[model samples]
Target: MDELLDRTAEAAPQDLTDGAELRGSSFDFLTGPGIDLAAKAQAFHAWAQTRVAHGVFPYAKRLGGRPGATAELTLLDGRCHAGLNFSSQEYLSLARHPKVCAAAQAAMERYGVHSAGSTALAGNVEEATALEAELGELLRMPEVLLFPTGWAAGFGAIKGLVRETDHVVIDQLAHNCLHEGARASTPNIHLHRHLDADHVERLLKRVRQRDPHNGILVVTEGCFSMDADSPDLKRLQALAREHGALLMVDVAHDLGCLGPGGGGQLELQRMLGQVDLVMGSFSKTFASNGGFVASHDRAIKEYLRFYAAPNTFSNALSPVQVAIVRACLAIVRSSEGGERRERLMRAIQALRGALTEQGLTVLGHPSPIVPVMLGPDALARVASREMAQAGLLANLVEYPAVSLNSARLRMQVMADHTPALAQTAAHIVADALQRARALAGATH
Candidate 1:
């Protein structure tokens, strides 16, 4: 225990006060000085290596095979642990579907895996074109443009359409990509409180008073990944319309995983085809690494094809990737998709209930994510190590990823997660927390 807690020999006394404390290890990478980039990483690496030795680092554990309710995780020491997996973000469990795999194989046979060029020139394939049409139909939008990844889609959607003169009114808790895209394009960015439509309204009104003629793009997410909550999109869209602003919703986490026919928040809110722009990723509920943006105007599609650097410069989604997503979409729209959503909801409820029964404070509303809040950051690190050792694998989100002293476990569920697994996992988590709190309490 002494060896596990000792600082590295070269660590300065200041380091002992900083990263030697458990709370500082997670922030070095986030708040570390960028002037000497390698120095920042070196400091973080020193602190993180100690966490690894203590088996509490809990990042970048390689997977052994296909992901599901349970998976084989290979730790840093080359030891494999098979545990109840709650780390994967796949809500639909479609990654290993037989039809999806078969579609990939067929597309590989036809297109030889790669798309061969960027979509702006020669990489556009028939499968992707058909996918765009299908997504347009599913989203109930007039046009769709595909991107290489979900991140690219979010970034490009804002970067492509909004000019430097345009103002962006975004949620405070919006995804990093959206913030980065807005930062890259313009300096006129206003952030409102998270999920506060009234704040959005005030910001919209403020921006209009200052620059009535300039375009204002209102950005938000359909589902916040960390907290498992959603916003009132209907009121937000109306606010944007009243203020003469464009509303764009990023459905990366919820699309194809929520709402009727897997149409996501817009559909459930009865605002499908009503928002000015919609963007989503296939990696969440669908079975591929791709994304798309939908709009009610054809000009947006044509404009993005040429203007969006990701679409014009980057290689389009491979034929196999497109085919895999196409197959997943077919299932997402069918009666089987409805059944899977029901199963997913049940699994979500079961896991949340199990956690609550264990006396853990579960955050936000019920969704695939059940955030079990563990405070003080230090306790979360200890609890993470205990959970890993106890053969229960889940993500340990601490400072920077969340906030200081608000660390929590973001347990993601799949459609196929069984009730028995949920109950057992909850027990393991509870036991881990008990033991961790005792050990951390004794350390003082």
Candidate 2:
């Protein structure tokens, strides 16, 4: 069965071109009949090698400097391309902010590089402690706990609070770390339809009828990373409360990037101090690498600090990282933050309008992420290569990252992106897609 599927997965040998790859999804090599894990990796690696040779493999391209409207990208072959970059997730364009950089330098001088030890031991710096307090204040859920990375925070929040017997009712399109944490900790995970609060309520009701006593964590996100859509948080929270469940919203992609105060979806939905649990990563808009969980109960914060493996076993965030976020938080809460948010929305609208003008389908709301649908895996791959050649950088997300054959270019918008830049990016995207469609059609 696997062999039969493989035959139709990639582009036919006769259809090969110099800059075009053998089209296939990550799902193709994800599973196989093998006891050794290396066997599966080998199969995937063999396939990926073909993509690299054709210069169409989109992942893991190194950035020469901080990501901005115009940035440099280094491919695996050591070839460098500088162009209008819509790849990196620097929403507020704060990664290289003068103040952010200054804070990092000062912290480095005082504490040196690396946290040196796990927080469970001796790595809790005063900055991290202070940052926790600041985040707590912003969220209005005065109890907070921190983790080294955003992934760690999401995973830890789940692994720490919920027991194996507890139920995890999550959105089907929630982030991978959230899903993985749920799978690792519990067997009774119920995935509701994407962004459907009604579906979640149905699952919650069903779970309560069967296991009313066990804890239920209704997991979701603020601004889903791929689709850029948001759940009705107010409704979801109310439903969770009615059914005796706790709602945990991962705001990794939204916090520090949305709202007038940069409080993200929680603030937009007027849920700042109301939700049961709010967790988010600073990497997206806060210009650093850290994440935190904000809750109303101080006891939950302390409980997670000791119980969460990602928190207890892993090292705390470095002083430099802590300082960067502190500075960014200040910027995110100021009038300047509001101005940047306005500018960001303008860029998003401009890009969306331009893409739409070119007959492309732009998904979701006017968020930092702009997902332009391309439809087929082959077209997406070919278009990605064409975009690179044309000096435009945007991510082509196909199966495994998205649904099968529902490929799209997930462009990350920056606050500093000008209207001119957006228009130029749209033209490049349209031209590339048109060429890809023409080429693919010819091959068929």
lDDT of residue 167 for candidate 1: 96
Q: Candidate 2: misplaced stretches above 4 Å?
A: 1-20
Candidate 2 C-alpha error for residue 153, in Å:
0.6
Query: What's each prediction's TM-score?
Result: 0.93, 0.95
Best by TM-score: 2
In angstroms, the error of model 2 at 47 is: 0.3
Tens digits of per-residue lDDT, candidate 2, 125-159, equal 99888999998888998999889898999999999
Residues 106-208 of candidate 1 have per-residue lDDT tens digits of 9999999667688889988898899999999889996999999999999998999889999999988788889988998899999998899989988888889
* Model 1 accuracy (lDDT, Cα): 0.84
For candidate 2, what is the lDDT? 0.87
Candidate 1 runs further than 4 Å off: 1-21, 30-35
Residue 211, model 2: Cα distance from true site in angstroms: 0.9
